[model samples]
Target: MARNILPLHKRDKTDTPSTRNASTIVPSEQAPSPSHEPKHHHQPHRPRHENALHSYVNNFWRNEIVAAAAEFAGTFMFLFFAFGGTQVANTAALFSDRATAGQENSGLTQAPNTSVLLYISLIFGFSLMVNVWVFFRVSGGLFNPAVTLGLLLIGAIKPIRACFCFFSQMFAGMAAAGIVSAILPGPLNVSTNLGTGVTPTMGVFLEMFLTSLLVFTIFMLAAEKHKATFLAPIGIGLALFVAEMVGVFFTGGSLNPARSFGPCVVTRNFPGYHYVYWFGPLMGTLLAFGMYRIVKIVEYQTVNPGQDFDDHEAAAFKPPKDAETAEQVGRPNVAALAVEEAVEEAVRIVSRGSREERDEEERIDGRLERGEQPRYVSERELLGRTGHGRV
Candidate 1:
């Protein structure tokens, strides 16, 4: 295959669309030699309706199902750990009271102590970090309904899908919290009984401000692919930790409305906290979206022009130029290649390895039979296989 390389020039910050387009492509026509014929690349064509349907199905899974699942799982895990930690905090305090009474009067705060605050904060932080890590590849770690709504406002997510994801996160959070509450040994009174954290209106506004700051931090960290990628969760977690420290005494620092509303619904304690839960987080999210737009403008000017937007948009908007050529192309199909590689691996294992290896191979094959893709190994492992070694 003959490759055509296009050299890209940096456009001025103030360049108009036409001026940018002028600098974008510099076409050069090369005369063909007697030995080398000019190769014309014809775009692949298909029936418009068939093509549209194929494209829609492919994109539906990529943009909807995969995206929604990531949001759902992230939200579920976050609520599970957060509310679970809250319950644990309450239970531990109950036990601590009994222990401290037996001994001489030691000056410790009563049930729902400082330790509870720290533990709950840590759980919320850790769960968020894990969810971000898991879903960053898919939905960009948008675990919050408010954040999703903000993205919709900025044209990041489609309006219809945004509504679906927001509701999904809320429902998932509530269900997960309810399940956690049920499994734990306690008075199963579903009427303002359990620890459903709520606070005053002032506290709600404060939480909105703090959550806005936190969401802004997430936008900034995710916008760039630097050390901030790894630090995003830490930054978010620490922000939550600090917020909790300041606001736990007032309203449990429920920066996440789903986190607050979930427990409240499960425990059946509608202490008018729902108003703040909806309005505060949504307000903060919108504020954060504004901050991101400003920051993006500055960042865009500073960063060198690259393939990020161009490549992404091309994949989304354009069809392959040659359908027949694409089908005939012999390059490895990543999905198919993975399955073949896994099968070969299993054969090698069963042929020469231990019982454990055979059992593992069977398990892997079962997953494959059940339509699961091969497990994605780390970049280091991939590099090693390619003989380029690690970074």
Candidate 2:
């Protein structure tokens, strides 16, 4: 089946980014209430050029441009802090020791001091948390390609939008790296590679495991519709923090492929196994989806014992009565209910017909083509059986 690729304003069904303001700001004639009627209904029609310009601006703002711009801005902000924090920490450590020189002089020195580790971990983690909150309403706040990949695979985001997000994140990373490189001294080392003595195999495994944790955490918190959204960023941040604490020494704890790719793009420092950054996190995201499916299976069995999973029934979800009313009143762009209802009606009409039934339908169509009024055939007439009243 072709996936529906509706605009963000049209597709989102969640409570976040309430379209209430947009709707209320520009009340339409379709609004049922008299109080919502426009004050200038008698005004003359707009000029063709003005109408076209208005439509262009409205469509651009609500559909394509706004969300992509938000992603770009969010990704840029995230990478700025990420790269800047690493550089600042390294520079601080370098100056901390006068006798030390070269790579050992930086905060990224092999010793793995508690203070430096905590500082960098917290900085990256909290920076991600802040950006997620900032862009949550605008772009779903997915600053990582791994997260975007997971969402794409799970059918959460459209493939086209996911591609845009991936490009935005990578571009932001490159830009941030370039800026950091320009700001910091030439000799300072701020690459995202694994620490000294860490083998490529070990680094890959570490990245895989950490990214799995991060992606899985996002699935459990941010992606699930029933879960509270306000704390989703916090949960994601904490997951990153945990991953960094353990995986930092092994692979620089870079769960994000873009984060790893950025520094490499700037420094031209590609290891023989630099491909691990792409492979490991992507593989981890795939695994996270499998894990999420298992959880869903377990939950389904617990809630509906002895019943086989019905994909169609699950997909045809009806919101609660209050939710339906809330959506009608608050979200004007929500056309999912109408779309689903139309689809359901089409399916019902189609399912009631078989190959033999199609022949009957052709006869009815032929009669209609002849301009004769089509007669309704009751089930009893078709089955040659009497109705309950007649029998």
Per-model TM-score on C-alpha atoms: 0.55, 0.61
lDDT of model number 2: 0.71
Question: What is residue 152's positional error in candidate 2, in angstroms?
Answer: 0.6
Over 1-391, each residue of candidate 2 has an lDDT whose tens digit, in order, gives 2434664433233444565565666657655564654544354478655544465587644544566778878988887887788677666766786344225422243345666667778878988999998898888999899999998877888887888888988888888778878877754355556676888888777788899999988887888753266789998888888888887666677788888787777777676777878888988898899998888665532333313224543444443443323232232223576688789999887787666575665565566568665355553354233222132
Q: Which whole-number lDDT from 0 to 100 does residue 35 have in model 2?
A: 64
What's the lDDT for all of these models? 0.62, 0.71
Give the C-alpha miss distance for residue 369 in model 1, angstroms: 87
Off by over 4 Å in 2: 1-62, 98-110, 185-188, 300-391
Which 10 successive residues of model 1 have the least lDDT summed?
Answer: 101-110
